[model samples]
Target: MTISMNCKRFAILLIAVATLGCGNQNDIGPTGRVNGVLTNKGVILSPHTQVVFLHSQGGTAAYGGTDEKGNFAIDSFNDGNIPIGAYRVMIQPPESQLGAEDEPSAEELLENSNGRKAQKKDAEFAFKYRQLSTSGLEFEVKEGENVFQIDLK
Candidate 1:
């Protein structure tokens, strides 16, 4: 009789702790803080690469790059947290390599004008996650801080 009472009490306590969030899980509010590390296989990708989270519902995209240690956080264009929903992730070279929009360095311009080719540095990632449809990486953002350890092929 005592054993059964203890088990029942434990179960009730577990359920009470599980549902201690601010409100209903379904109501995730406006946004969710999204951050993670980009990894290839088991190794972290620390190169100058950008991660893009395209909203599954086609609203906006949250994008950011990893630091030297390979950690990244994504923010929308409005400088706010990512909207709560599913998103398709894409990894690519940073904005500096997009060309035209980013101005070249003075030395690079001089080298170009003098017919001397400027040395080009490429991002270290070799896998094909540069496109939304090809990456095959998806994540759902819930309310509060969402940490993802995204591992790629």
Candidate 2:
């Protein structure tokens, strides 16, 4: 009889603890945050790449580059800045490269007149979730902090 009572007491305690623990599981994050690293296949992208967050209502937000560790944070726009809808994220190098690179100097690369920068003016790149393009990727922003890992390939 005593053993049965102890087991019942233990079960009640377990139930109470479990109920308390799960009481706020849905309240993890009120305003969502997006944090992720960008990669293509297995290769991580260069820091010079730009990440653009496009809103459903036709506007864009920009983020520069990730840290040396490849971690990025979009904590500011967590409160549905882009609205609760579809969006296309885009990443582009300073300029599109036509062929293999031989490590040009930073100064030359920075100049808009250098190499293929002028020719790339009409080059199109932006991927949509429904259709397809090279410059963009599609993502649906959910409520709360969302860690979205992007694969550009």
Candidate 3:
């Protein structure tokens, strides 16, 4: 009985030590770093831009933001790396119609008897890039670092 108890305790200790050494395994599998610049007809975009990478498998999407220089890095799964796969890229400008400022406030809508008028502004650039399907932009992320120079016509 004594020998059996000692053996059980040793096994438990070994398992505990092994588990501690291995650390947490919550990470998403097989990711790669992606960095890129956004440009329009050879001109670097300075607006606050958001770049989204929709995975071809139709699940969680990875995204990043651009600085004044239009540089961005894609992050997914709460990490700085994105899962290695093909993605349809979508680029959104700073002042999109879906922006908070573009939408009428609840009070303003309530005050207006005619309801809210749909305000349409002339697009500065081709707005088709805002949609993944219409963007015509595709990128394949590999295991490791990737650099892309995205140019919009």
Candidate 4:
């Protein structure tokens, strides 16, 4: 009977230590990392583009032009206040550089600008859409790395 009691206590201690370790393993830094590639079909993009991370509740996070190899990373530190929900990802090719020629020219966009005056703008720019193919996707961000590979076809 004494030996049996000792064995049970050892087992309980082992289990408690394991549970504590496992819990601590997942508690990483408050900052979450997001990384991925953007591609259309099999070819990687050549010019610069913009990537936007939009929360369902109207907040946003933005990452900019990837390298020639088409890779991007965005790291953000939160107070862990992000609500659990779906988030929309958006991509916008820079007005100065785009894949297609028929696309509108950035010069044309600022033609009326005096270089010091504000132009008409709204949430549309924040959620701007460059082309039908480059629109963002929706993803849920947990407490770890959120990787997203976008395939616009």
TM, every model: 0.59, 0.47, 0.64, 0.49
In model 1, the worst 10-residue window by lDDT is 118-127
With a 3 Å backbone cut-off (N, CA, C), the pairs that clash in candidate 4 are 89-136
What overall lDDT, based on C-alpha atoms, would model 2 receive against the true structure? Answer: 0.54
Give per-residue CA lDDT, model 4, range 80-140, as digits (tens): 2333346677777656643444333576557746653232342123223443234646777
Off by over 4 Å in 3: 1-27, 95-122
Top candidate on lDDT is: 3
lDDT tens digits, residue span 1-153, model 3: 999999999999999999787665555568788898988887766566778888787465888887878899887766777777888889887644355654456776677788744333544346678788789999998889999999899
Candidates in descending TM-score order? 3, 1, 4, 2
Top candidate by TM-score = 3
List CA RMSD, all candidates: 15.2, 14.6, 6.3, 12.6
lDDT tens digits by residue: candidate 1, 19-89: 78556644425888888888877777755678889889856687888887779888765555767899998
Clash count for candidate 4 is: 1
Error of 2 at 30 (Å): 8.5
Off by more than 4 A, model 2: 1-31, 58-64, 75-82, 94-133
CA lDDT scores, all candidates in order: 0.75, 0.54, 0.77, 0.58
Question: What lDDT would candidate 3 get against the real structure?
Answer: 0.77
